[model samples]
Target: MLYQLRNAGFTLVELIIVIVLLSIMSIATFSYLGFGAQIFSDVVGRDQLISQSRFAVERLTRELRNSLPGSARVINNNRCLELLPIHASSSYLELPQPGQTNADFVAVPPDNYSQGVNYEGTYLFVYANSEQRIYNSTTQRKVISGVTEQDSTLIFDYNTTPTLFPLQSPAQRYFISTGPVSWCLEATGEIAGQQQLVRITGYPLANSPDLAHGDAQRAVMASDLYNNIEGGQLPFFTIAATLQRANLVEIDLRFARRQGAEPFIIHHEVHIPNVP
Candidate 1:
């Protein structure tokens, strides 16, 4: 009687093939996503390591540069560096007599040196016959009004001969300059039991290396301060004497995410202008 309409559907074989292809594609997509996630994790970790380490190194550099002439010391045995950071500076326009605030000194700080040390206040030991500090808590500036002794500047005591200032007694040793200062670095358990570069800062006795270690003012400047470093390579800092004092500083910093991760090494030889 009539040409009946017939519905056409996918055959069983074709349906099976389509399912197999879809399964394969899904598996591939998931695999790709997982791989991408791992890559992202590694990238993030490395970046984080870099940022933390770089900050520490920059801080160290700043402190080293800001250190009073010839105050940076690297204790080889402890793998630590010590420095007396300058609070502020003004040129010694003319040696001012006692009780003179308006002397010819017009705060001639070095390049990038802060101007606050003189007026703003610091724990600076004025060079009278003996070191003296006139500190005003409110102003946070050392008042040098009554201090006698023409050379009230902090720079004093040069190591005329070879000296080995060890970490055990940093304050007792003769520093390049005698004033408030402290030390740190290559310390263990500073960051997650991992070796880290630390910055130790504080006001210690002028010539008492023994009392120099007050407390670790700053810690973990750069965690993982090592990256397979070895041989003529200082993993952190080294202070070598030129002439009679520690004038040349060599810093070797190695950054890495993990034990076997790629290393980022930064090495610098800094010759301090202030070091006498």
Candidate 2:
């Protein structure tokens, strides 16, 4: 009997079926990996947002806590908070008024100043209870010309014209300041038409809050800010001090990791002592 020779090879139908199965499996595998990658990206974005928001909030809180009483003012359409930072604070021994013979010297406890405390370019403030008193009134604010160390006291002398303080602190507290500090949420070009929170300093003290300056130093505190100011949602609000309460600063910051994404929001309140 003669046996016919048969070729041993995969048929066309079997090859096509195998190829289809392989394609389906590949698609499934890639889909799973893509889903995992998306999850990781979302998590990273959320963590980044939290970290940025926390730092900005904490810094603002600490600075506001140390600021002079009644010095906090919201300017620039409620987008900026301006205040004078206190470098040193203590009870004053003497403040020369206009009628007093010694119109140049202010005495304070010697221990308040450290060995490195520089008096140059600093200011002295007394009984600054309102924004007007802190910013506009010259009688309540004086620039320090020199500082002297005595046996048991520290004296700050003013070289400018001597004038009497309009009001005196009942607690006799005196506050020392270097200059004004401002925190503002403004637009920037770094992120393509996005707004960011910035801390500005090294600018001259102005009677009105200066909104823009070329020489001032600005540092970004937080990025991706999405606060809506025109819709009645403001980032900063000041609750004036009442007889029964202290001054309150309300901070509301809204951020987003990407454009068109839901915002991550933070609400904080800082209570400032009304001891001025």
Candidate 3:
């Protein structure tokens, strides 16, 4: 039998159809991949934001709990919290003997030395007489080891009424210095520029509440701080205290994104120690 060789290749129409099918499938796959990628990115970004916000709140809470007496106060329409932070908190030194004056001193342990407990450099100091936090320059200059009741190292004399001299039985009082680690909102940020919470270190060189208009020492503690008026949260920082009395601090934080989902709100109420 005379057998003829048949064409093994596909027809032109078949080839065209296959190409079209492949193109369609490729487009669908790419679209799916892109959607998946976008979802993943959103989830990661949201998680990061949540974690950052929580961390910021936790850190602030810890510091507030141990804040020096009469140091924590809300200012700037509750948009700021002014406080003389602490270094290595320690028990107040013992009272001096008869006719002996003991300056402001804490018998800090050797281990805490690394924490910059000494008053060698600029630091925040709060003592027996502090109804409002003030930035004292002269006080930052003197830092002699050991407590001397007379001529204390810590700053005394405040513009506020009923100025404080050397505290009586100060050992029971609370005095804290930011000790290099301070707090400031950033001058610029991705979202909350000049308003983002930051951690400042070794700041307030001359000791003055008049914080620099634009400081670079601040490190971002949180971004997108909510200062809205919707939740009855007046300012970012609010303080309620009496002269040489108890203080009530209210910190309202809200984080909302311009894009993506809605933001979150966090509130913390902090009361200083040594309430008499």
Q: Supply every candidate's count of residue pairs whose N, Cα or C atoms clash at under 3 angstroms.
A: 16, 0, 14
Models ranked on TM-score: 2, 3, 1
Best by TM-score: 2
Give a tens-digit lDDT track for model 2, residues 161-249: 44567566888888888899999999776665468999999777777756566768889998888787888779999987877988899
lDDT per model vs. reference: 0.48, 0.82, 0.52
TM-score of 3: 0.66
Writing each residue's lDDT as its tens digit, candidate 1 over 60-172 gives 67776766654565553446666666654443333333455544322223344432323222332222111111111211112233222233333212121112111111121
Candidate 3: clashing residue pairs, number: 14
Where does model 1 exceed 4 Å of error?
Answer: 1-21, 76-78, 90-183, 187-193, 206-215, 227-232, 236-246
Give the higher-TM-score candidate: 2 or 3: 2
Please provide, for model 3 over 20-137, each residue's C-alpha lDDT reduced to its tens digit, 9 standing for 90 to 100: 9999999999999999998898788778778898898788878766655556654444455666555544443442223555422333332344432344333324343344233343
Q: How close is every model to the real structure, measured as TM-score?
A: 0.56, 0.90, 0.66
Model 3, position 262, has a per-residue lDDT of 70
Query: Against the correct fold, how does model 2 do in TM-score?
Result: 0.90
Model 1 accuracy (lDDT, Cα): 0.48
